[model samples]
Target: MRLAVSALLLALVATPAAAHFQEILPSDDVLPEGGTVTIDLVFTHPMERGPTMDMARPARVGVMANGAVRDLTPAIEEKKVDGKSAWTLSDTLQEPGAAVYFVEPQPYWEQAEKKWITHYSKVIVDSYASGEGWDAMVGLPVEIEPLVRPTGLWTGNLFRGIVRNDGKPVPFAEIEVEWVNDGSVTTPNEAFITQVIKADGNGVFAYAMPHAGWWGFAALIDGPKTKAPDGSEADSELGGLIWVKASDMSAASKLLIKQ
Candidate 1:
């Protein structure tokens, strides 16, 4: 009996546990200027620990350019994913050059709480040049597509979602889900579950929930868009939010199950 118990323990140890949070972006590279970029921040946390944990809070994202780090205050738009609340940050580059930027979640939790933790990401900025004659160049506006929220049900109390863009799916996009119980509204880093997911095909992706609750989801999509020189009409690369409910499936899924 002892040997059997030891074997079971070893098996459990071999299994990989879920991470606490993640960042979703289209690519590690960005343009130096004349473009806008959007990033989605997804967080996952435990709900059984009471409503003291709030996963909703405003965060500041910073970019590294030249030899110094610059704080990027993008326009944040809020949306709901599968009934959970989420937000997106959009910003534009104004300079021309190549540099790396770091995106970090700032002051998301109270100082009194030592359990609060933060995360970060690195972004590359490319040079932007335009002129006439031999140097005559056509510039494309950069736009990052949004990541799709996870869907479907599975055993082991796990839920997953995929991140995709412009009909094409990207692999290893950062994703984070935060569970904030039923009646709470705030952001506490201790209550976040984050992970990175790679796309399979047809722009598909997935992630596993630690348990379940009202989870706020977010992701980042980056790329370029083309426009007329007049700037009257143009095509935009899309980026936005995706939300999913684990406790309940969509009507389409329900219908299929009934069928």
Candidate 2:
């Protein structure tokens, strides 16, 4: 199963035709306080049409926190987006509480002169502190517990699952999904389906299926394979299968996965 999924992902190396530059990180309205946060930008183009042109020059990222602007050129990494080379910038969040940030392709640069630029993306920060004793008691400690949630009907097009780490809700973990239809398995890249969205600041994930039928949906979280004290690792096979029925989507469904 792992090999099949990996092959499917690798098949997506071809670049999409009409590339659209967008921000992929700092997507949440609230972020945990106190830690280095990395934001990534994703450039997407239409794969069905033709390849998007490679960026001739490097792009720039502009970061603003509490009315202070900082140039993020040093942390920029050049990489391929939808098969075309693109630029990415990563930045860290300091201090506590909420802040706003944005990213844009450098307009003054020679290459970005004629290219279309993306709108600014916003980010909100929430308090996250690490300590011990009474402070630890007030601070949110990591918990790895089972999650029980409703699947909202056996809609063959949807799969729902609960996520947790060390008995606590795991917010912000990535969830990748694939489906097995009849005797054929759909790869992540080949499957004409929407991406599985991870749970919010609370461990929860859901995805809509592409087709109706007896499909076996599998999920792999970018967490640890073995159980850990703090519940952090790339454990994909932790949460199991989710069954759905297209015709009976109106009926409420429930799912429970234990870690």
Q: Against the true structure, whose TM-score is highest?
A: 2
Hey, what RMSD does candidate 2 come out at? 19.3
- Poorest stretch of ten by lDDT in candidate 2: 131-140
Worst 10 residues of 1 by lDDT: 131-140
Clashes of each: 34, 29
Tens digits of per-residue lDDT for model 2 on 1-259?
9999888878655432222323334423233455566554543322222234455443445554545556676777878756876666545666554333334333211132222232222223333421111101101122112122111124444445444434455676555333323334343553343234566676666666554332222232332344323443322223322222232433222222221
Model 2: runs farther than 4 Å from truth? 1-21, 27-30, 45-59, 106-122, 125-259
lDDT of each: 0.40, 0.39
